[model samples]
Target: MALTTKVAAGFGGMALVLMAGSGIASAAPDDSVIVNSTCTYPQVIAALNAEDPVAANALESSPMANGFIQDLVNTPPSGRQAKIDKVRAYPAAAQFSGLIAQVANTCNNY
Candidate 1:
């Protein structure tokens, strides 16, 4: 009876752990949802509008005025806005500002 109880408890714990892991996996964002720039600026606009309202407003307010977005558009590698993704992923404000400066300099001619 004691051995059976212990086995049942162990199985219960394992079930809980598996449930938690599956929940975490489901909660993770899907990378495929991210729209690539080559899809068209309107698609980028729609994706941004759906995913980030504040950033989308900033873009809509002055799409070209945003140095980072403008830079990515003007000198896009592979004609895509991958640079914006790099800038958006910056964890710190200082790093983002630095990227903005770099973009400005790189796109100055445009």
Candidate 2:
């Protein structure tokens, strides 16, 4: 579930971090040089909970992704129809529910 993403500029455009929970990082390929990193749903919640700097850097790098996450948190979908409606309203909402579920579950210690 790793996704190569864009990082905040200060980390250097060429730098791609990791969230495998191993703390190891590597350089992004030339074709995907803009990618900063990717992680499973749980890894992100864990990293944020632990106050890990890597997660902080990644979010800072991508304002779009960060904003998307913030919007989901502020207004959650009701159900399948709600999710479908979200997609109809904004395409990115499709990813929102799963992320919110994972985060909410983790927060509830599920």
Error of 2 at 31 (Å): 31
Please state the error at residue 84 of candidate 1 in Å. 6.4
Q: What is the Cα-based lDDT of residue 80 in candidate 2?
A: 20
Give the clash count for each candidate. Answer: 0, 4
Could you tell me the lDDT of residue 34 within candidate 1? 20
Models 1 onward score TM values of 0.32, 0.32
Question: Mind giving the per-residue lDDT tens digits that candidate 1 earns over 1-110?
Answer: 23223222221111121111222322112211222223333443454455445544554555233443434444534432243333232223221232222322222222
- Per-residue C-alpha lDDT of model 2 across residues 1-110, encoded as one tens digit per residue: 32214222211211111211112233213212122223333454464445444644465457655654443333322222222222233322333333333433343241
Please list the Cα RMSD from the true structure of every candidate, rounded to 1 decimal place.
20.6, 14.4
Query: Which parts of model 1 have CA positions greater than 4 angstroms off?
Result: 1-37, 63-110
Model 2 C-alpha lDDT versus the unseen true structure: 0.33
The weakest ten consecutive residues by lDDT in model 1 span 11-20
Predicted structure 1: lDDT:
0.31
Q: Model 1: clashing residue pairs?
A: none
